[model samples]
Each structure stands twice: as structure tokens, then as C-alpha cells.
Target chain A: MSDSKAIFLKDAAVNAADGDQRAFIRKALGGYYVNRDLQKARYRDWERARDAASLAKWSAVNDLAAVLEQFVANFERNGGVVHWARDAAEARDIILKIAADNQAKAIVKSKCMTSEEIHLNDALEKAGYGVVESDLGEFIQQLRGEAPYHFVFPCMHVKREAISELFTKHLGTAPTDSPEELTMIARRHLRQLYVDADIGITGANFLVAETGQISITENEGNARLTAALPRIHVALSGIEKVVRHLDDLSVLLPMLATAGAGQPMTCYNTLYSGPRKEGECDGPEQFHLVLLDNSRTRLLADPEQRDALHCIRCGACLNVCPIFKNIGGLAYGTTYQGPIGSVITPHLRGLKQWNHLSGASSLCGACTDACPVRIDLHHHLLHNRRNAAKEAPTLFDRVFHHGFNFVIKRPWLFAAGGRIFRATLPLLQKLPLPYMGAWMKTRDLPEAPARSFRDQWKNPDA
Target chain B: MPDARSDIFARIREALKVKAPRPHLKGEPVAGKTSAAAKPWLPDGGESAEASLAILAEQLAKLKAMLIRVPDHASAAKAVAELAAAKNWKKVAYHGHPLLRPVAAALPCEAWEADASFEKQRLEGCDAGLTTCESIVAQLGAILVSSASSGGRALSILPHAHVVVAEAAQVVPDLGSALALAKARHGDQMPSMLSFITGPSRTGDIERILVLGAHGPKELYLVLVG
Candidate 1:
């Protein structure tokens, strides 16, 4: 991607001091509002336990870190193994070792962003294990052999006809766009894998340190079956996923519902702590939890950015983010793409590598407002820019910040500098403007009129 | 399990330097402080058991899942057989519920109880899989599945087609009510496999196109036996 396109948000921000951000916010707000109303009504029944249960759930979050460690100990004592990996490489090794030791031939996976972070599928597939993504969106992406576009809705970018064509090519059937036909096609195909698979892998939406149970929520029964049918089940989650108690599930579930899909709760909320007890007919015989730090610990250490840990991976921030809507997920150039991605990616991958993501947002506070846990996302993005500046400031950026600091400090030079730039715009336009002018490619730039906006405001009718 | 769960949580809290992250807990009211009227999980107001069933049926119907109203157990069994033949489902797997006996006997296709044989038969080719729901919740239109005796866990899940028979009396208002009923009925002896299915197996994974039965039963038939 062109640097301007790659850092599209940075380009957009240079010219977005006006009402441009507001227009983007208006569009995204429409989408969020429509989805929110639909979800409330759709999962109205689950909402009955909304108030009491959800409150209980948040109490657990208040004591999350403690609860999570307890959950890890319990899992180990119960004969379930727990592995802590500080980064993706370590996480992938832990999983690969488990898969190899078990002599896994084929594996099934539930949606787990942690696994995505570690690139578990490629690692496993490279070792010659057939891996299938059980979640419908994941499955579609898996079939196309691609990565998830969004955290929850992986194939949210794929259209229906595209899916029909995907199925037709994969199954050698006539292309059809009806959801029922496509579902039947996938069902017929995936059922065989459920029984035949040797290992099941999933992501935990919440790890109840209380129950030693990894809570996975999904509408399709795949996660349940994925975890249940396989002989070995592996759960991957970030350290921030833990909560105090099962009672806390009530609070978290509703928040996830409202934030993820606007539902009160998903259809399936399956919790598996360890291996099934005696007399249990289904579920894995072996259970493993890989606690991945993957920059979470570093993020936790940074007092300014630690709140990023509070994210439940609900994707609420992305759904409500104005910049995310127009750019879609692919532009972020990481497993996670969106407002949360922009803030977290630089921290996880280094601000120097992804300084562009820091400046990608419209700085609209919609993401912060929409966060169920109320993460200050816009503030974090600004914080990311600061980190980038400190870690990898360009010569131009250094000069600019120094010049900016000087201008604001010295009113005379500041005024003169503004006048000079405004007057020299015509001359600069003729000289083929660089970085700042890239913004004009996708957007129109208004000419600087003879009268300044500040001057006009002072005169009222100037 | 309770003690173990609690102990684990306690220790983890200590290890992680778990402090009370929030200033004040935000959740259910302190009992009487909140109005009793604040029933978030309940319908508009409250729905009677029967009314909940009606609403559930309507919702299921809207999803294109077939809900057959049978007068008796015999008719319910016959209805299954009729559906099997009508849908051209040849290889069939039956959860050995007493309610399904007549249907299993009547169907011309090969029938195996939810067992290893059923699993083998399913692998070969099955047009539909038949089972009886252990319970149904009206509020969310969910059906609970237990794989203890009749239905094998695999039979309910690892099939392209699934048909479930539920007693109208078993339908409750919501998940909480459903859990309450399960707790009361089982009294600590939970079933081996209890699955609550709302709509047919569904996924909006692809561009938000809600695809039904992606990994589980693609088509779900609910026979609401009166």
C-alpha cells in the first residue's frame, strides 16, 4: 500500500480539524444505533437477567487479575495444564507441543483471537495436521485460506454472492446465494470433521477464575462440539480475560451481547474448566489453557496504556469507530484492525513499526463511549502517537514538534509562520506538495480565502 | 467443584496482584433497594408458561424451523415418520426415547439408537437425525439436550438434519427459569450432555449473512407435543 493509503488515517487527520470527523461519526452512529436496537429486541429474553447478573459479572472484573491466577492454579490442580507465554512465539510453541505430543492428525478450532495472534493454524497445518475453523465466519475465511478481517465477524467484509461462489468452488456445486443452501453445504461438510478431529482449539471470551471454566459464547453449536467432541481441547486467551467468579458471567455476558452483536447473550455459552468428570459422555479428555501475554504484560506495565487490557474483544469500539467504517479492517495490516487495533498494535508490534496506526483515528470519542467497560480509546490513540514520537520520531516530526512548541511559546513567530504558510500555499502547490497534500487525493481541499476564519469571526460579517 | 472453583480464584487473585479494579461494584441491586419491577430478563412484563410457548413457537416458525404440534405421543411419533418420508431422509439416527419408538419402527430407513452404531450409521450417510429434547425454554426459544440415555451427544450434533420432540409443558419462560427448572429437577445430578439450542445452528460469520446449521444441525425440526 502507498504510505498515504497505508497511513490513511494520518492523512485524514491532517485535514479533519473541521466537521469532517462529525460526518464520519454520523454515518457510523447510524450503523451502531440500528444494530443496538435490533440486538436488544432479538435477545430480549436473555436481557431479563441483564441487570442483576451483569452487575455481579462486573464485580468480578473489579477483581479480575486475582481471579485469573486462582483459575490457573485450579486448572493445574485438576490435571488440566496451564502454560503462560509472554509472546506469540512462546504461545505457538506451547500449542504446537501439545498437538504434536497428542499425535493430532486433524484439528478443529473455535474462534480465538489469541490463536490468531500466534498464527496457530499455519503452524499446525505446516506440521501436517488438518485444521478446520468451526465458527461459520472463521470457516469461510479458512476455506478461502485467509485471515479474519474483524475480531468477531471475520468475514463481515465478504458478500453473500462471494460466499456462494466460495462454496461452489470448494464443493464443486452450482453457485447459489441462499443462506440456507450455504449453511447446508457447510453443515454437510463440517459434521464429518467434528467426529474425526483429534484436537479442538478455542478462545475463551472470559476465563472464570472462580469456576476454572473457560467461557465461550457463540450462536452456532460449533464451539461446544469443537471442545466436546475432540479428545484434547486447548483454550487460548490473553491474561486480561479472567474474572472473579461465575456470578460475574451475568454482567459480562450482557455487556458482550450489547457490545458484540447487540444481543442480550449469544445462544451458546459453553463453559469447560478441565477434562470432563467421570460418567460424562461427551467433552475432551484433556484440556489445556495457554495464557498469552503477547504485549499485554508490557501494556499492563505502562500506566498510561494499561486500560487497553480491559478490552473484552467485543469489537464494540470498531463497530462504532468512524475511521474504521470507511477503511475497513484490512488497512490496519495486522490480525486486529480497527480503533482497538490501532492502539494495541503499536504497543504489541512496536510503535516504530506501526506509527501510522497511531495517527489512524478521527479522534472521535465514539469508541470510548461505546466501550462496555468504557475504555478511553481516543485518548489511547493520542497516547500511541506520543509513544511513536518518543520511540521513532522522524527528522521532519522532530523539527515540526520543535517548531510547534516554539511557535505556541512565541506568539510573534507563530502568527508570522501561519501567515507565511497561508500565503505560500500557492507557491507550495506549484512545487508538488508531499505528505500533507496526500490527504487531498481522497478528499477535496478548500482554498484559503483572503480573510482568515479567526479574523472573520472577530468581524462577524467579514 | 464449588470449593475447588473458589480456592482457585482466591489463589489467582493473590498471584496477579488482583486488587479491586473498580471503585464500586456495578451490578444487581442490594436486594430490596431496587424495584421488583426491574426484571430485565423477563418479557415486556411477565409471560405465562403457555404464552411463552406460543411466542417461542412463533419465533421458531419465523426462522423456517418446522414446529409440529402433535396431539399425543403416538401422533408425535407418527409425525416424525411422516416428516422423514416427506423429506426423503433415508439413513436415520434415533435417540432411544420412548416417544420416538413408533417413528423409528414405522420408518423404512435403517435406524440405530444413539450409540456407536448410530455414529457409524451417521458417518455412512444420514438424511436426518431424530432426538427428543430433555427440556425447552420459551423465552429464548432454546431446546436442552442431554446425552445420558436416548440421544448420543454426537447424534444431536454430528448430523446434517436434526428433528427434536419437546413436551409443551417443558417450555419455560427464559434461561434463568430454565436453569431453575434444571436445578430443581436434577438436584445436583446434572445430565452428562445438556445443550440449549435456540435457533437452528446459526452463524453470521460471513459478511453477517446469518447461515443456519454451519457445523451442527443445518435444519432443526421441533415437534411440540401437547
Candidate 2:
């Protein structure tokens, strides 16, 4: 393993064992699972909805070229500008240019995972613009100068007391710890920023090809203000977010809400077709949509693993993942986390450095089951592991596998090896074995039998 | 930009060289005709409009939005006055919808025009904003407001409290019906912004505790007129 990866795993292992963090995650995610189950029960045929949504996404990915063209045409027809970005640098440049052209001094942003993927906030900050995150969770994370703890819940790991401290330190609010009071404090502070900001930046949940509109779903209503009050509005999204029909939201919206937050629908599901229309009083005067292709085509290039692009970023896999619940979101050390993150990060970033993430899972199929788009996420992790091994196999792995294959193929040698292992179990346990010690850190080794099952089969009486 | 677009498309075509043919791209409306067939799996609120309205009310209440049923536009105006008085709002900003003239006239306090020039200073000064909705979703208890009918996105979002006036005829069974209505009304030219609001602005980001009015209206009230 790379030194960085080894250190990351070590840090994650230590963090996973923290009692307070474990308790917080368990309580928070447990409540989420309960609410999700209750909300899902309201649907008569959730599985059918999931299947149809998956099919729609599959069709969109298949006809991506035509669909994207149609979206651009319709968007332009509605007075929206579309910018194609081949990489993160290009995308950043496009946004920076817009900000520079407008002479924008302040910017308000809603929660967008794609923005997190591109590190847009840091880039914009470096350019000397005052960029503020409007989403409450993201606002807290930003104030603490930390990355998001979870995809949906950016500050899920932070406790209320920490938030009270954060507010006191950052906003200079009274030492009020109540959630409602804290929300009001943020609302009062950010409401002014929204009005004064020259630019608003957001992420699109879905891009409708037929109408040339971008759908943004949120409960906090920050996205609405961010899209409405600014003179310039820019939406950054991965090309995979495109959907074939506007009616697709009928199925996709509920699926996303139920899977993401256990709601039938978020409070605000706004579709921006273009900039403010000819007679419109509010909304941005200029609207720009940036379609980013940062190593996504690489995943699309592999037919076998292409379905990984179907992920909706609902984060259900993370909520249900045992490893994530234990080790937490920060452990993955990538933009996306949990099962979907592990499967795609290697491809999105690079395999050699991130290949270790594919090994983080127990290969359980919960992620596949929870996936609304039916991405077969766990199987994708397996594919990543196989590809990683093929790309660069270490000498230790080769030697161990070859030795294991040789002994297992010979019956007599296998039996002899088993006997030897059972006899030396005490010695092995006594010795400070490196690998076995690490394995035994969180688990117990099963006791070896007195004799092999093969031995018994050959001579039962003995 | 053009080069990047073409290059990405070329890569996609190369990657999908041996893929299946896309049937939906052939000018056949896959969702248009088969929407009904796809409707069987969706939740059934009711077959009658009355039943759907009941479900809508129940759902909206669950989301913490106040829903008041009025007999007609006159009563809607009265309800608006009563609500404004209860909230002690002295000044109200209202969208210039012809249907909302009665509510504007009946307002007990000073009413301000929410027009194109309605800037942040005016919105902040106003205690409440009144607007009209295009439709309401019964299944999810969502109010559908478009820039065409609701004045603009800011009217429904920026005020301390947002009050929406809607006719019972505008209620629909689900989001699909809402989309159908928009398609029929505007055809190729849609409003720049179409928002579906379920309740007051809220967040659960701080310790997963529910809090209202994160960055929009702290209070949401629906006055449904028949």
C-alpha cells in the first residue's frame, strides 16, 4: 500500500474506535433509517419506481450525446448559456471568468456535491472573492474550516455544543445552543449576504433534455435565494445528471427524497429554465450552466463499469454501509464517500493511489440494494479491485497467491499444512506477528480443529 | 468550449460503439403515452377531487404549513387580513396578479407593490409577501409557483412570511400532473423559475434538529379559494 493510504487507513481505524463519534453516527443514522422506512412505506410500489427511474437513467446515459445537445439547444432557446468543461481547471476558469467579467465581489452558494468535487470554494477564495455557503450544514463546516462529514448531512459528525461554540466564535452570537435559534442566527446573517452578493453558484440535481431546465431540490430554501437574488447565477453539474423527460422528476424526486432524507418531497424543488425571462422581476439576470467532464468519460469508456455513472448521490449506501457508519465519512479522504465513493473514486481521481479504498468494504450487497438507480455498487467495488490487481500487482500478493494455490491444489500438502498450522497456533499467537496482530485488533481468530475434515473422512474410526 | 463538447461526444460515441440502440431518441414520446401505464405504481390519494383535497390538507399540515379553506375570493381576502393582523404585519408586499386585487384592497395595513424594481431593501422591510400559485400537489402537499404567475421567485422566498393564494381548481393529484399543466400552458417557452414549496423553509443541519426559516420565509400560509 502507498504510505499515504496506509496512514489514512490507520487514522480511520483510530477514528472508528472513538466512542463519542460512534455513538453520534449510530444515533443519527439510526434515526435516518427509521424515518426512511416510514416514508418509503407510504409508497405503494417503491421498487417499481426505483426500476423505472433506473431505466430512465440508463436510457439517458445511452443517448447522452443527443440528449445533452438537445438540452443545450433548449437552454439556449430559453436564454441560458451552456459552457462545456473538459476538466476541473477548465470549469474553474469558466466560473472565474464570469465572476471577473461581472466584477463580482461577493458570492452565495447552495450545497452542491459537484462543487465539492471540483473544490470550487477554495479556488474562488484564492481569487479574492468573498464566497459564502448558504446551506446550514455547509455553513457550519465552512466556519470550522473542515470538509463535509457526509454527502447529505455535511456536519453530521459535529455535535450541538460544537455548533454553539462555532457560532460564538464565528458569528459572535449569544451562547444559544438550540437548533431553532441557531438556524435563525444563520438565516439573519445570510439573508443580508444573499441580497448583497453579486453572484450565486449552485449545483443541479437533474438537467431535463426536453425543456432545457435544471432541477434543484432542497428543503432549506437557500438554493432558491441563491438562484433568485443574485445578478448572475451559475450552475455546475456533471453531465451524468441529465434526464430524458421532465416527467421523470415524478419518479426521481420521490426516490431522491425518500432515499436521501426520508421526506416525500423537499420543501423547494425549483427548475430554472434560463435567466430571468423578459418580464420577470426577480431571479438572476444572467444564467450559466457548466457541464463538467472531469475523468467521468474514463468510467464511461469501460462498458463493464459504466453503470457506476448511474449513481444519484442519494447517499443511501453511506447510511447503510457498516464500514462508513463505523469509520465515518472523513476516513475515505475523497470528495465522495461510502460504497459509491469507493467504487468510483479510483476512476475519477486515479486508481494506483485510491485502489486501497476498494478494499475498505466487506463486499456486502447492501449498497446495491439501496441504490435507487441499481448501480450494482458492491460489484463495482469488486471490479475496481480486479482492475487494480491487473494494473499493478505487488510481489507480496503474487507470492502469497501462488503459494496458496500450490498448496490448495495438492491434497497431501494441504492436509500437512493444516496440521502444521493447528499445531503451531499457540506459537503463532504468542509471537508478535504483524499481519495477525492487526487482524486480531478488532476480531478474534477461530480455534483450529484437532484434525482436518479430510482426515476424518478418510478414517472415521481413527 | 466547442472543441471540448465535440471531444466529449466523440469519446462517448467511441465508448458506446457496441451498445444497444436508444429507442426513446427516435421522436416517439416514451413518457407522453405511457405515463398512464406508469401511473399504476404511484400512490393513489383518491379518485375524487374532494378526497385529493383532504389528502393534500393532511400532508401540508404534516409539513407545518397552515392551510385555510375559504368559500370564495372575498373570504380569502378576509382570511388574509386576519392572518396578517395575527402576525402583526404592518406592511405587506404583494404580486400584481389581477386575482389578488381583492386581497390587496382588503389588507388592513399598507400594501406595497412587488414589481420588477422590488429590491432586497424593500423585501427586507416588508413583513410579508403575497403571491399566487399555478397549482398544488395533493399527494405531497406542495405549492407549485412559477415566475409567470407568482410574480417572481423572490416574492415567494425573500419575505419573513409568505402567503400563497390558490383556487381549488388548480389542485392536482401529483407532480406529474403539475408538469403536464406547465407543458400545456407555456409549450416551448417555460417560465425561468418554477418552484414547488412543501412547507416553510427549514433545516436539520444542526445536530439533526428541525429548524424553520433557514434562508427563506420563516412562515408559510396557504389560502385556498373555491
Candidate 3:
């Protein structure tokens, strides 16, 4: 195994045993499930809605180039500029150039996992620009200098008291444990930042091809303020965010909210076509849409795993994933932290380095069932495992599999082997073999029967 | 940049070479076959304008937004005055739309003009904002406000309270119809910003507890006029 993969496994094991993290995940996901169930109940034909959304995404993926061309044309027609980035570094450079050109000193940003994917805040801060995260969850995570704990809820693992402490330390407010007070404190603090910011940065939920509008959905109204209050607006999005029609939001919006937070709809779903129009006074003067490929094309190149690109990022799989619930989002040590993350991270990064993530699953298929786009996630994990094994085979793996196959093929050898294994179970338990010891740490081998079932079947009269 | 775009497109085309070209998708892509095959889901009162208005009121009330129905523009004006008085609002910022002239005229407060040149700092100081919506969505109880007609964006967001002046005819059954209306009205060139404001700004990010007015308006009131 790679050194980073080994470290990741060790860290994941420690995080899985953390009682507080586990409790937080359970409570938060439990509430999420309740809300999802209630909101999903409103739809008489939920499955049909899912299918329609899936088809729309599939169509977009199939004709991505044409759709993106159309999007660029339409957006540019509305006075928006579009840039193409082959990877993260290019995406970051393009953004920095925009900031430098505009002489921006301060930037306000909305919650965008895409921005997280590219480490945009770190780059911006390093360049001497004051950056403020406007989403309440993202702001909390930012104050603590941590990555998001969940896809939808960035600070889900953080308690109110911790947030109160964070605010007291950072914003210099009197410590208060109330969620409402903490939210208000953040709101009051970030309110001025929006007005002072020279630039606003955001991630798009969907890019409409028919109209070339970038749609963003939020509950706190920060995105609206971020886009509206600034002189320049830059939206950084993965090229996968495109949808074919404006009407597609009718299905995508509800599906995303119901799956992510169990709301009928988010409080705000705004579509931005471009910069301020000729007569408009409040929107950004310059609007730029940066389309980042960043290894998404690698995933698209594989026909078997291409459907994984259909992810809407609703994070339903994370909420329902057993492995995710136990190990938590930070355990993965990647920007994305669940089934969809596991499926695509290998392609986005390198497969050999990230193969361990695919092995983390129990293959419960809950993630597949939860997926709105119906990407066969567990099967894809199996495929990833197979690919990993093919890429790097060890001598021990070859020997063990060959020996097992030989014994299974011979009935007499298998019977004798089974009897010997049962008799030596206690001895094996005490053996200091590294692999065996690791397996026995949290589990015990089942007690061996007095006799083998095959032996008893052959000599029942005895 | 052009090289990168072409390279990405070339890779995509190579990957999709094995699949049959779907010629039927040439023109404007048709709405997905799935959406047409199975009847799309709609809320309880998402049938007609009258039924949708009732449902919109109920849904908005559940989201902590007040919905007041009036017989005509004059009554809507009266409702706005009563609401402002009850809330003890002393300063109101109103969108410079002809539809909202009646309410602005009847407001019992120092009214501020929300125009293209209106100062955002002053709008932030107002007690409430009065604006007109492009449409009201019944299923989600959302008010659709576009930058084209709503005196830009800050008028509806920066104030402590937001009061929307909408007409009964502007109510839509669901988000689908709302999008259709927007498309029909604007065609290919959409406004700079179009927002669907469901209620006062809110957040449940802290311990999954819902808190209203995290950043935007603390109160949202809808005055539906004939």
C-alpha cells in the first residue's frame, strides 16, 4: 500500500472509534432522514421524478461539449465571460488573475463544494486578499480552520458550545451557546463583509444550457448577497453541473433539497444569467464563469463508470452510507467524503492512491438505493477494487488465492483442510501473525464445532 | 484556454464514439421522456390560480411568512398600511414599479425610493422593503423576484422586513410553471438575477435547529391583490 493510503486507514480507524463524532453523525443523519422522508412523501410519483432527473443528467453528460458551447454562447451574450480550466491549478490562476485585474482587496464567498475541491480559499488567502465564507456552516468551519465535515452541512460535527467559543475568540463576542444567537452573531459579523467585498465568488448548482444561467440554491441568502453586493462576481463550477433546460430545475431543485435537508424547496433558488444588465444597478459589473475540468474528463472516458458523473451532489449517499456514518467525513482525507466521493475521487486524483476508499465500503447498496441518479455505486466500488487488484498484485495475494482455489477444487483436500482448521482454531487465535492479529482485534472467530458438518452427514448412524 | 477547451471536447467525443448518435435531440432538446411518461407530481392545490393561491398562503404561513389577500389594489394598499403600523415600521423602501405605486402612496411612514441609483446603505437601514414579484409559486410558497422589475436585488434583501406586492394573476401552480413564465417573458435573454424567496432568510446549520433571519429580512409579508 502507498504511504498516504496506509496513513489514511490508520486515521480512519481512530476516527471511527471516536464516540462524540459517531454520536454527532447519528443525530444529524437521523434528523436528515426524517426530513427527507417527510418531504419525499409530498411527491405522489417520487420514482418518476428521480428517473426524469436521471435522464436529464444523462442527456447533459452525453452531449456535454455541445451543451457547454451553447451555455458559453448564451452566457457571453448576456455580457458574461467564460473561461476553461483543464485542472485545479489553471482554475486557481484564472481566479487570481481576475482578482488582481480588478484590484480586489476583500472577497465574500458562498458555500461551494467545488471551491473546496480546488482549495480556492487557501489560494486566495495566500495571495493577501481577505476572504470571508458567508454560509453559516462554512463560516463556522472557516473559523475553526477545518474542512467541511459533511457535504451539505459543513460543520455538522461541531456543537453549539464550540461555535460559541469560536465566535467569542474570532469575532470577540460574549460567549453564548444558543444556535440562534450564534447565527445572529455570524450574520451581523458577515453582513459588513459583503458590502465591503470587492469581489464575490460562488459555485453553481446547475448551469442552464437553454438560457445560460447559473443557478444557486441556499437557505441563508448569503449567495444572493454575495452575488448582488459585489462589483465583480466569479462562479467556479465543475463542467458536470450543466442541465439541458431551464425547466429541469423543477425536478432537480426539489430532489436536491428533499434528499439533502428534507425541505420542500430551499429558501432561495436564484438564477444568474450574467453581469448587471444595461439598466440594472445592483448586480456585479463583471461576471465570469470558470469551467474546471480537473480530471472529470478521466471519469467520463470510462464507459463503465461514466454514469458516476451523473451525481447531483445531494449527499444522500453520505447520509445513508454505513461506512461514512462510522468513519465520518474527515476520515476520508479528501474534499468529498462519501459513496459518490469514493466513486469519482480515484478518477479525479489517481486510482492507485485512492483505491483504499473503494475498499472501505461494506457493499450494502444503501448508497445506490439512495442515489437520485441511480448510479450503481456498490458495483462501481467492486469494479474499482478489481481495477486496483489488477494494477498492483502482491505475492502473498497470489499465493493465498491459488492455495484456496486448489483446496476448493479437490473435495478430499477441502474436507481434510476444514477438519484441521477447526481443530487448530484455538492455536491460531494465540498465534502472533500480523494479518491474523489485525483481524482479531475487534472480532473473534466463531467457535469450532466438535465435528465437521460433512463428517456428520457421512456418518449419521455413528 | 481554447486549447484546453478543444482538448476536453476531443476527449469527450472520443469517449462517446461507441454510442449511437441520438439525432432526435438536434433541435431544442425535448423534455425527458420519463417526465412525460409518468404524470409529474403536484401539490394538493396545484391545479388552478384560485386553488394555488389558497395553497400558497397555507405553505407560506407554515414557513413563518404572512400572506394577506385583498380584493383590489386599494385593499392591498390598506393591508400594507395596517401591517406597517402593527409592526411599528417608520421607514419603508419600495421598488419603483407602477404596480406598487398604490401601496407606496398609502404607506404611513417615511418611504424611500428603491431605484437604480438608490443607495444600498440606506436600504439596509430601512425598517421594511416593499417590492413586486414576477410570480408566486404555490407548491413552495415562494415569491419570484427578477432584477428586471424589482429595483435590483438589495431592496428585497437588505431590509429588516420584506413585503411583496403580488397580483392574483401572477400566481403559479409550481416551480415548473414559474420557470415557464420566466422563459416566456424574457425569452433567450434573462435578467441578471432571478430569485425565488420562500420566506425570511433562515438556517438550520447550527445543531439542526431552525433560526430565522440569519442574514436577509427577518420578516416576509405577502400582499396578494386582484
Q: Which one wins on lDDT?
A: 2
DockQ (Cα-based) for each candidate: 0.26, 0.58, 0.53
Sort candidate 3 into its docking category. Answer: medium
Ranking under DockQ, best-scoring first?
2, 3, 1
Candidate 3 chain A least-lDDT 10 residues? A429-438
Better of 1 and 3 by TM-score: 3
How well is each residue in A1-462 modelled by candidate 1, as lDDT tens digits?
Answer: 335344655534442543553453344345546767665665444433344433444444445555566777766655678877766877888889998898889999888888888898888888888899878778888888887877877877666798898888888877887777776777668777878888989898877664466677787888877876778888888877876644455446645766787654566665565675565545677888887767665565565666677677888888877677666665576788788888888778776767677677788798887776656789998988887678767887899889788789986787677787789877765664457655655654456567665667789775
**Residue A373 lDDT in model 2?**
74
What is the DockQ (computed on Cα atoms) for candidate 3? 0.53
Q: For each candidate, what is the lDDT?
A: 0.68, 0.86, 0.85
Clashes of 1: 18
Q: What is the lDDT for A102 in model 1?
A: 84
> lDDT, candidate 1, residue A40?
62
Estimate the TM-score for candidate 3: 0.95
Fraction of true contacts retained by every candidate, in order, equals 0.31, 0.70, 0.63
Better of 2 and 3 by TM-score: 2
What TM-scores result for chain A when each predicted structure is judged separately against the true chain A? 0.86, 0.97, 0.96
Per-residue CA lDDT of candidate 2, range B16-88, in tens?
Answer: 7757433222223465432444465666555689998998999889899999999999999999999988899
